[model samples]
Target: MLNFFKKKAALVWAKKHVLKSGEFKKNSVKNQEALLLSLVKTAEKTLFGREHDFESIRSVKEFQDRVPVADYEDLKPYIERVKKGQANILWTETPEYFAKTSGTTSGSKYIPISKEGMPFQIAGAQSALFHYIAQKNNADFVNGKMIFLQGSPEMEEVFGIKTGRLSGIVAHHIPGYLQKNRLPSWNTNIMEDWEAKVEKIIEETEHENMTLISGIPPWLIMYFEKLTEKHGKKIKQLFPNLQLLVTGGVNYEPYRDKMNDLLGGKVDIIQTFPASEGFFAFQDDYTKEGLLLLTDHGIFYEFIPLEEYGKPEARRLTLKDVELNKDYALILSTNSGLWAYSIGDVVRFTGKDPYRILVSGRTKHFTSAFGEHVIAFEVEEAMKATVEKNAAQITEFHLAPQVNPTEGLPYHEWLIEFEKEPENLELFRSELDEQLRARNTYYDDLITGNILQQLHITPLKKNAFHEYAKSQGKLGGQNKTPRLANDRKIADLLEIYKL
Candidate 1:
């Protein structure tokens, strides 16, 4: 408990003193490179020493290309070593903490995190607010109690001293002073069971000053539904000072409208791109377009063309060489001693120099079952456009890729839960399909050839994903139903109807 308070105090101190260091504003790519080199040197001394004993890396590209594209499987050996109470191969010493989690597709990955890693998470988490302050310049929003809708604190004991998963470690590092009051205490303790944590959050916050809320998008949607149901109109009455809602962990496209409705459309909604591997970027602006990379912070940044990274014929690019509007897979040589680790995320650049990017999607978060590559962003766009045009009310939704071997008909199955059914869903779906096909030529050809059939809409009860997650014992904090489920196991869980 004292440690928690210390962390909170440190964070509050850092929040006032450390944010917006002029390093982030250094506009030139050269300046960015200089900043990265400095951080790399610092990490070298603090983490592994000057020689980098784990593996030799010549240049940024050489470091990237020579390293094989590995998911958590490749790193399992290192984790096993750590589990045996030995130092990991990646770094010589035991990490200050390890971000633990069962990855979306990879099951379980233990990411080594150090004391330096904590600041990045804290800074990135803080950036959401900084971005808001930069936009509105509102000092009032700065002082209020911001509620973080995060994973249960029970993760700490479950993963032990090492911060289990990125979110768990982040919870541990939340500035010590704010731990008791600002953050939801129930969710912060990893020892308590998930159900108990959720119940605790519900009980305490029913009459609290929850001005700012943060968490993964899906979990927030689920909790918000419950809050609305339990309090009726009393939600706004209880938390009358609420002004900002910050969500991440997944794309905010599907639930944006519903969240706005439930929050009375008064609060400014923000999204961030934070992960276990590292806090890559944040939506520093309101359009939620390009996530400005935290360039000057402890982590050094690098990108490789998605097509080239793993292929036999491939080359890599550094911060200096990345072209505008190109999609590249993310590779990081972080302060936590993860050298040239391919984080499986894909991002596209929007602004240059002090670079800003949009997290396009995960490399694996795509559907090519019909030879039509439909990424999460595309599906999200289509869903957003469809809902906006029909003026329909929707709480949340998911898309599952289906392949019917009998007809060889490959199409997308959309399981959507609407707050109110529009009068013309069929028309909405048809228009949405047209919009999607127009966006991607591959999808267009697939649709034209009938290789990809029409979208099948499946409406569910209002809190379906929430209840579904609850039933699975994974309801609170950072858990959310997959936005796009690719395989049979996921399909079984997400598919509400098939047509």
Candidate 2:
């Protein structure tokens, strides 16, 4: 009876708005801007009224222009002040949760999250999920079971506080809201309680009809492989209903072929762009080329030209003003009290109205040592196409830049492990190099000057990247194997051979 009420509520919510994500996507920029303005007013009342005594912004342009840019480092002092049990610089109230992220350049960062912020994240995520379902007419799939391999419960504490990273916090709320019968009660519990988690997954494998699965690609690949090994041929018979797969947290190119083999075929795959900060985007339709932006959500979006991150003349445009096909650094101002926050992601606009985009790569996740700029997404796509062309299977891999000592050339070196070594390995490497150079002119220039040379490929043992990530104490939660290392430290650590 309790579950019935929950499902009924979810259905009602779905009917009210989620079913209209497409309509909402078609909403004009002028309408969305109006909605954003109204929400910003409400946010001011909700968050800053008591703290800064902010009544409202004098004007829309004032809100965008007057608020200075803030990065994670700038928030550190405010976080530290709150840690000492004092009033924070931004929010007057104490944060109910802190979503942790492994700092890209540093060890770790804990972003303070308020209760209001949590709901926005949840709403954005659910809207994205429903938008995809509605677009594909796959509403029937939601009635089935989904198994999300997630971070462990042991991960809740940071500096002795009972909490979790953003992903875990989101997972912690899933069971309460979701229809009980539709979801598998079986949880992997990937957190610190490994012994119990393994036992639980093993026990649940006996159940039939697990229709969908979602998790970090790397970890899920490892988990499925382990399950296959444990159950042998009986594994497929155990969970027969899994037809759709969702993966995020890392690039899926390296394990693409291996994952298809594990799943038995090319299952319907959807990739999501979510972070400790918020739900940036998600695959709305399999047939679509890009992710549809959740425009009605509380986030006010801005973009800065990619090449001009720190330049004073770097053009920043609001959602109503952005141009297509240009890569731009994402800047977000949200209801969570974040003002002009640099999210460290680069994206290109692919469509408007339902605003579609491709997450190009991180701002820093590129190779620029010898002027050969290779972004992560381009590399992932090139590798996937290469694998398909060669008809080969790759289990895992990492990429790093290698500079020629004598010629001063900078060429990319790939450390890969294939299911079966291909006959044309050198050709495959050349194809990838050529594709990259064609995509980014910097690589072509570097190659022409002997500043970048022929690419190198090195095969590794299976489970090499998984093992490496485990060794680094980065088993889960927004952690990824660095594909392109800029600094010599990580480059040296991941490099297989010297140039």
Candidate 3:
């Protein structure tokens, strides 16, 4: 009786979600403009707002003109003030929580989650699930156990505000209705050691009706591997009711083949674009290739063309000015008091009418070692094509330039952990190189000019990436291996695990 009621309620909520989303989609532009004004008005009395003269800003153009685009470093001082129990430094009120994230140059970043902005983050995730339920017209999954493999929910006090990983903070906000169905217990979640946590999770959930599983692809793959090892069966065989896989934080395409192989059956996937800064988009249509951008959310967005990124003359474009298929640096001015903040993500518009986007890559997470400027999208697409053609399955892969190789010209080096290696390794390498070259003209030019040689592939031992992550003390909880790097920091470390 309880399960029946839960499924009916879930279907009702899904129907309402679809209707609400349709209304927002039709008026996205107006919603964006109004949101910007509201954010500006709300923060007008705060330190950042006063400094930028937000009181006089009446239009999007005016706001853009008044506040320059900023990275984390630019706002570090303001965030520092907030950490020391300051109120109204950036937003109107003191932050309810700080979503701590690992940063490259800045060490640790503390992204403020405003009282007003945090609910939308939770709602975005709920809406993603609801969207799926609406499309499938089935709510059976709601009656079964669902696991979100995530960070430790344990938090520390930073002044009066709670501070923890974004995943951890979000874990605290799981809806009351879903609490009974969610697993693996709070004690299991709070375990800091990822390996131990996964073991506990396996013990707790092994016999349950795990109808939905959510996490980043790599970590979820780890969980799946552990489950299979324990049960001596494929994931689908163990949990026949498993219906959905929710993923985010990295591209899912690269991990698709391996994940499918692990599951050993069909399961729908929903990709989301989530960060400490905000929840931006999620896959609303299972048949569609792009995520539906949340226009009515607390965020107001700007797009800077990828080619013009970091240049003085870069144009900051609104939704109306954006063109389909062009890569742009995603910028945000949000109700959380972030103004013209460069989130460091690059996205491309797949549709205009309802505004769907694909996260292409990170602005900094690319290889430009030889002026090739290869982004994650290009490499992932290349790898996808190569793997499909070669009937290969990869566990994980990373690319870095071999600037001072022992043997020949410096070339791009791919360290790949293969679940199923291609029959002909050399042919696979050449085909991957060809696919990448076809996508990136600069790489093709370099190879044609003999300025650089074809990319080299290094087969890695099993659990190579796992070992790498463990070595870095980033074994789980939103940590992802860098796909491409200009330097050999990760590549050099990966040498020990080479097959």
Write the residue-wise lDDT of candidate 3 on 1-499 in tens digits: 9889989999999999898889888888888999899999999999999999999999999998899999999999999999999999999888999999889899999999999999998999999999999999998898889998778889999998999988889988999888989999999999998888888999999999999999999888999999888878999999999999999999899999999989999998999998999999999987777999999889999999999999988999999999999899999988887889999999999997799999999999999998998999999999999999999999999999988889889899999999999999999999999999999999999999998999999999999999999999989888888898989999999999998
Tens digit of lDDT per residue, candidate 2, span 78-193? 66655454433455455666776668554577676666667867776676556555455444445556676656534554444446767667766664545453332434554354
Deviation in angstroms for 267 in model 3?
A: 1.2
RMSD of 3: 1.0
lDDT of 3 at 443: 96
Model 2 spans > 4 angstroms off: 1-16, 31-56, 85-88, 104-107, 136-144, 153-162, 175-200, 206-208, 234-238, 251-255, 404-408, 495-499
Total backbone clashes of candidate 1, pairs 3 or more residues apart or in separate chains: 20
Which lDDT tens digits does candidate 1 get at residues 253-356? 77778777777647776767888777777777676467777775556666778656578655557777888877788877666667657788888888774578
Q: Worst 10-residue stretch by lDDT in candidate 2?
A: 45-54
Model 1 TM-score is 0.85
The Cα RMSD in angstroms, rounded to one decimal, for candidate 1 relative to the true structure is: 4.8
- The models' CA-based lDDT, in order, is 0.66, 0.66, 0.93
